[model samples]
Target: MPQPSSARLHEFRIVSNDKIAQDIFSLVIEAPQLAKTIKPGQFMNFEVPGNAMSLLRIPLSFARADADAGTVEIWYAVVGDGTERLSRMKPGDTSTVLGPGGKGWGVPAECSRALLVGGGIGVPPLVPLAAELARAGIPFDVCLGAKTASELVGESELDALGAQTLSVATDDGTEGHCGFVTDLAAELLQQGGYDYVATCGPGVMMQKVAEAALAAGAYCEASLERMMSCGFGACSTCNVETTEGMKGACMCGPVFDASKVVVW
Candidate 1:
């Protein structure tokens, strides 16, 4: 079952911002009131002023919430009108955000070892989840894949959290390894110590990661991407067919177990 969004709009101030890559922009959204309750695996839908190209709420994963700082950070790749609008927003620009939506990454304190995998724009939400695992003193590893080495984001930040970051690229002659993030995942799983695999990326990439995890007998989870409207469960745009049946990413998930996702 899917749920509706609790907030119609959350007033936030952009305190600081920067670029992580060609299309990626990271922003610090000041929203003290919401940060306190935001948990890992959650997202916020934003209302971008209607422009000529598109008119719909853009729902993005909640990258990180600095509760103490009264701010939250989200990394988005400028692909279309909504994201382009968000990317153009400068410091002090006011934004209307909604949610803490979906059930985010599942990080169990007692789990043996955790592996986080991210690809392209899909990598944003997992950053904070990695940070949380680090805060819990949980030994974890992260494998990130992108087209080129320069495209990889949050490596240093993840490292600061004590995660052994593995960077991979398709060109092979780049950085850590030359292959898919799923390739890195297979190599790590070979070491044979992981208890969980959580990921977000191109669905094709995640499907491969999930396959690898399933082969290794590790628990796996993932956040999904889809066309959305209503920012909540009301619209059925983001529904996914699972083993149990259909579920909405806007309500029941943006994140779900790898076992539940129906790949087609």
Candidate 2:
């Protein structure tokens, strides 16, 4: 786990901010030091301008980090006031950010095969993990889910990263399998070659993925989303109930051993 001291506040400038899907935006920022240090599942808290009254920064996970280009790419859904403000920021807008927060994925040394499951906006963090797996010569598969075809993101990017098999499920039957992504995940887990599984999504979706991974005898890690009022551990707003006890997401995790988590 990364300590509060390891996470630094850096000045960042928006390189590009574009609407990629319905109510979803892809934001690229120039944060050279952050781009170089951020890990696959680590998150950043951005100080969006124009919200003078709102004190909380928007916490987001990056989809990609290009160290050579000194850029970090984030994919986020415009769900609230902060994000709505973030969506409006033009290129060249400048702000400050706190990152690389918390621990990232802990892929086992013997992991030869892996499975990644994501749903809705939760897909962003998994994208970089897929790239890491590919670079390590680990063949993996992906299962993605969205409410509708227009809401889905990251399939193309994951495919580009060489996922052995990419499957999708949409609630409305507007895309791939007409059901929960858990259906695809369960089927894949049953095939039995994966040694590790990583998932991020709605609580219910991640819980299901965790169950399936456990039954398949694979080690599973999940990135949990919580209300992080403070980017650091001071606020205690992002506490997650684990078997060990309650731990703050901003410091102890956004990622945790699936089996150790008590509450979804």
Candidate 3:
């Protein structure tokens, strides 16, 4: 069995909160201890403030972490009551968080070039992964897509990282490329040279990316975003169909080998 997040519950104070695009928002939290241990691809279960109706905590992937300043960041879209309440919170408000949950991406030490792909809200987690790769001196590129330009976030941030290449796609034809991000992935794969691929997004997008990666003979992994009531394996709502049978995404992975998962 894959390991679980630490049992420790962290009380984090909201340091900064701002709406970046549309209903999307960015949150920087003060959690000195948790920041040090948090890893890329891991998620945090936030105790939503004033959410009396919804008993479940909100799970968000770490967008960035600053160990030096003792801060952890997350990006979210206001889709429901829980997130609506979170957006109303002030800087000094405090919330409980249980995290660095689930298995994460392993940096490809042997690969010279890697591709990181993210779509819409899925873009957040890839930010930290890019940072980690940069620190490890792994050359990489980023491919980001969204339904529309307004829903997109983090292009400039990824560009600022000095990635080898950057590609963007939008369904509306308002930016970089028109049509699906998977189309872009297919094009990049045809060009070759990327030995590794990591992606997170809608299921359809990920499935296409996986197929392209396999055809290109590149190793690939994906982060699944399922309905997880509990950030741990107890709830069983996050089980994924894999070659090894059903596995708890919260415990085994939000990250999984792209080829091993049943994407249909």
Candidate 4:
């Protein structure tokens, strides 16, 4: 596991807010200090003050990070009123950004190759992770899944990153493979060169991916999404059952060893 984030509060100016996919929008925030320390699979808690309905800070992971530009991007689907309100804010608007929170995914030094699996809204976090892999000279392949072609927003981004290979699976046959991304990843893992597998998405999807990795005798880690009232570990709302006992997703993880998580 990676070290816990050095959480801080900074007022960030919204740099850009643009629609990336069907219902998903990418929100870029300017926070030099926070941007420098953020890593893949890590998320920030935003305090959007204008709405009476948004009483708590919303958690969003880094879709991309530009430490040089002093900015980090979050890809969020407008699933609720909180995200809807965030989508309406202009580029010059400011919001309280508290972060560099949660444990992030890490690839072991011994591992030279990795497979990244993501689904639906869960696909955003994998972008930074894949970039890091590319930067480190550790070759990787990405397998993303969505209900249809329109929802695969990160495909172009991943293509631009020039990963070793890119694969997509949609529920309908509008894209690459017509199946779950886990199935694609499983097929690749079975080919036998990958050293590790990292995934994030729906709980059920991750569970199946975990099983496949384990069956193939490969190492695997998963980033989990849970309802969080407080971005820090103060509130126990984001607890997850693990092999050791109960662990808080806000602190202990949003990422964990696939073998440890007791997925239903």
Candidate 5:
């Protein structure tokens, strides 16, 4: 398991904030220290201004980090009050963030090839992971899912990163396959070349990916999502049930061995 990194408050200035897809927004923030230190699959807690009653910060995983440029990009959906407020922030907006939190993907050095599965908003974290795999010269295939074509994110980005193959699925047949991405994943796993698998998405999606990876005898890791009330382990709201017992998502994970996870 990868150890959690210490969290700290960093002041950030929004470089750009734009709507990229239906209900999805892309936010780029300039925070040099954080940009240099945050790892793929780890999350950050953003303190969005404008809400006094909503004291808890918004915990989000980054899509990409440009260390040299001193910027970090995040993709988020406006599903709630906090996110709605977040989407309204304009460029040059400033805020404080607590981050470099939680353990990230632990792909072994021996991994020759990888399969990445992501759905909807969960696709953000996997973008950086794909880049890492590509940097290491480990070929990877991607399976993406969304409700419709307009809502899909990261396919083009992942393809640009040199993914071996990119497959997409939509619930409504507005895009590639007209079923769950799990179906695509299962088909790919059946061919038997992947040595490692990583997924982030809806609980059911990750659960199915975990099952398929296990069947294929591939080492798999998943970025689990939970309501992280605190970006640290102080609040027990993000506990995850595993074979070993309970663990906090904010510290012990946002990523974990898929086989050991007992609850999605």
Candidate 6:
């Protein structure tokens, strides 16, 4: 009941197949139909063509959605089997992509100023959200964490969208900031004046942002990365424990109010 039982596998094209870093890729998917409703934190379930070896689907986040162009983007890193196969694809090659699925960027319009934090592959999805914020005349800041300078994915796009692109690395002499992205996020939250915070990245990074937002009395929402078997709610692997109980990340979230999630 979380989403339609099934949707057609619309067209999929790979805009960029080059590795941003050692294991990262900027894979952009073009799904025209789904673009209209695609939101900030939402994700899509994709079926890379010529693959009968894996499970039913692979879920990817809604990195960016352009309705005018009739396409949705997924800036993903080659993680495992599914992603690695996807990374090898080129433009005009089709994929059985079915979505705009999952809980979307829970960016409330009531808040005018916010912070968007992403880690390596996590940076792409925030680009559309930043663009949305820009269209709304809302100001936002962005902090991205990568192991090194080469791993940073969407710097130019984020900058073009009007987000004050704050890039960080484990090494201090790299770019904008250094150390864990969580540290940069912590500083931004403590420095004050943000209405809310939105984060999508590694779970630990999102958790840190949530902690900072909670202590500061500002709302925080996160998009999580989980192993989802059935991109819809049929499989339970994507479920996470929350204050309200367990909710499936594929359905109830890819995005959730940090306050509702119970971190053990």
Residues 62-108, candidate 3: write the lDDT tens digits: 88899999999889999999889999988999989988789889766
TM-score of 1: 0.93
* Selected candidate, larger TM-score, 3 vs 6: 3
Work out candidate 2's RMSD over C-alphas.
1.0
Report the lDDT tens digits of candidate 2 across residue range 1-264. 336546889999999999999999999999999999999999999998897799888899999999999999999999989999999999999999999998889999999899999999999999999999999999999999999999999999999999999999999999999999999999999989999999999999999999999999999999999999987888889999999889898888899999999999
Error of 4 at 42 (Å): 0.8
Q: Give all candidates' CA lDDT scores.
A: 0.80, 0.94, 0.89, 0.87, 0.95, 0.76
Clashes of each: 3, 0, 0, 0, 0, 2
Minimal lDDT window, size 10, model 1: 165-174
RMSD of 1: 1.9
Over the stretch 62-128, how does candidate 1's per-residue lDDT look in tens digits?
6778889888888888887777777777888896888777777777556878899888778888878
Better of 3 and 4 by TM-score: 3
Tens digits of per-residue lDDT, candidate 4, 54-148, equal 58988999889889999989999998878888999889998788898988887888887888899999988889988888888888888999999
lDDT of 5 by residue, 8-62 (tens): 9999999999999999999999999999999999999999999889999999999
Can you write out model 6's per-residue Cα lDDT over 1-264, one digit (the tens) per residue? 255533445776666566656687666666677887777777788887556777668887766777888776666777778888888788777767777677777667689688988886777768777887888888888888887776777777778888854556544546666588888888888988888888877788888889998887788988877888887788799988898888888888878888888852
- Name the regions of candidate 5 deviating beyond 4 angstroms: 1-5
**Candidates arranged by lDDT, highest first:** 5, 2, 3, 4, 1, 6
Q: Where does the lowest 10-residue lDDT sum fall in candidate 4? A: 1-10
Candidate 3 least-lDDT 10 residues:
1-10
